[model samples]
Target: MVKTAKKNKIHEQLTPKTVVIKIAKWFLILFFGIYTLFPLVWLFVTSLKTNAEYFDNPFSLPAVIQFQNYVNAFSQANLGRMIINSITVSVIATFINIMAAAMASYAISRFQFKGKEAIFAMFSAGVMVPLNALMVPYFTIFSRAGLLDSLNSLRILYAAIGLPMSVFIVRGFMDSFPREIEEAAYVDGCGFYGRFLRIVLPLTKTGLVTAATFQFLTCWNEFVYANLLTSSPATKTIQIGIRYFTNQFTTDYVSMYAAIVIAIIPSIIGYMLFQEQIISGLTSGAVKG
Candidate 1:
């Protein structure tokens, strides 16, 4: 009788409210999962279909899989050159932005000096500045400097644009880090650079990966700046190269879809690789200060 009563009491603890909440949570998860994945699934399906098939039955599976579309998309779009350009620019820009932001964030987060808050505020404010607002000035400045129409110009621009957000993210993570480690290093005669290079940097790997992922994606997908600044075929990025498939009159939907899939692969791979770190870094410092 006693065991039966206790079992009844325990089962009653899971109230109707709790059951409803659980159901709602799963509902939201299913809803968003379908919403996010449907577009990618459709894009893949469209990429495999011929233009005639696409026109005949857009939503149905491809009657005959056109593997040649991928090859045509690659060669005709000159994605080979564009992919190389995007990787080079994104990699170099991400490296420079991460290195500079890490150093700046470390100084700001660890040091005490006049205008420290002000400096941090300035970088944070840069995040609000829209890229479109600076497009004209960037064009004029680069044109006069004889830097337009070159990959170096794009590299520099991408690095500069990514700096503010990187600094903000890294600084937030640094601020949340325990200071005892650094103090102990100091007592052991470790200088500022040594402490930063050895202890702080390694401890902040999640933050660094988060910042690098953001910077790389920004540089890779950026189209307006690439289009405005770069005029030559050799310097154009994948985003800009995608425009070649469409003009005022005609649009190659199949090839264009294929190219989009190619362009998005790197970003998907990158996110999948560093998703845990990104989630951890974003949430770690969120409640710290």
Candidate 2:
């Protein structure tokens, strides 16, 4: 009797409030999952359809899958070359942005110097200055400098645009780290650079990964600067190349859809790989001093 009563009491402890909360949580999860995936699913289906088939049955599965759409899209967009350009620009910019941001962040977080706060405030303000607002100035400057159609121009612009946010994120993470560990390293005669490279960098891997991911994504998806600053196929990024599928009169729907799907694959893979780190870094950074 006592055992049965205890079991009943345990079951009753999970009240209607708990059940409602669980149901709401699952409902939100299901809603967002469908919301996020629906467009990709539609795009994939559309990519498999011919123009006639797409117009005939807009929302249904293709009678015959058109794998050639991907081939045509890849060839027509010169995506192979564009992909190489994007990868190169994104990787180089991301690396430089993270390295520079990490160094700046470390100094800001660890050192006390005149005008340090002012400098950091400037970086924070840079984050608020919309990229579009600088487009004209950047275009004029690059054109006059004869760098308008070069990969180096994109690389420099991407890194500069991403630096402010990267510095903010890395500095926030650095502020959260215990000062005692760094103090101990200093006492042991570790130089400032040595302490930063060995102690700080390794400990802040999540923050670095988060910043790198953001920088890479920004470079990958940037359309305005690439569209304005680059003209040659050799210099254009994937985002700009993808626009070739549509013009004023004719639009290649199948190829356009296929190109879009291909364009998004890298971003998807990147997010999947570093999702945990992004979440952790943001959460920790949010609470830091």
Candidate 3:
């Protein structure tokens, strides 16, 4: 049996079709790798250039490296304050969003009750709704509640805005989780909450991490509602701080690029931390989205 398997493997490796397929896979991987990372490399390069160098040749190397652009992003602008605000808002909103999603998805997926599917459907439908269309009503409601010009407004809206998608992803993951495990937990005298807290929650780590990654990124990058809801600099987020270098009359292009690079760092960090879980979660049938 061992000799036969080895012979088959050697035969497969030597086949022209298999060789061609392997070559093509490597080629495509290289192509996509460059495609995705090229823009980031170009942006970093441009961020180091002066306005004169950028204008003279957008693609050329900088004559003098401008390390001050990064310093200016912090000194000249409120980038520091805005980064803190973004971090605070994103973390709090992600926690709330994930907790709510976990409970909602668990109940909807595990319990067979009348209108449960309908509730899930309604949540799913929210993803299709255009947020721009609701801006007027949301503005009125927040205005009445006096949440306008507050980070609390973003916290609430960000959690609510991504709730639909978060529910969708987590629910899909829960749906595939085996009922037999919970049944065994019940046989061991575990109550519903106990089983969920100990077994279900811990086992769903990948799905939760995936959902949290999405929720955090959404909250971090959200600009439209952040702009509409907050007017004062005290409530402004990093997304709004990126626009600091622009006006009708003039623009600081290099400084804006530097701010953008700074803005992208947290997202890259988040992805690097959760990328394993995110990739596995998506591949494990949680991407019914």
Estimate the TM-score for candidate 3.
0.91
lDDT of 2 by residue, 227-254 (tens): 9899988898889877899999988898
Q: For each candidate, what TM-score against the reference?
A: 0.93, 0.93, 0.91
Error of model 3, residue 31, in angstroms = 2.5
- What are the per-residue Cα lDDT tens digits for candidate 1 across 238-277? 9997898899998889999999999999999999999999
lDDT of 3 at 190: 99
- Write down the lDDT of every candidate, Cα atoms only: 0.93, 0.92, 0.93
Query: Which residue runs of candidate 1 sit more than 4 Å off their true CA positions?
Result: 1-6, 13-16
Question: Model 3's lDDT to the true fold?
Answer: 0.93
The Cα RMSD of model 3 versus the native structure comes to 2.7
Model 2 ranges with Cα > 4 A deviation:
1-6, 13-17
Q: Kindly indicate the candidate among 1 and 3 with the higher TM-score.
A: 1
Whole-model lDDT, model 2:
0.92
lDDT, model 2, position 39: 89
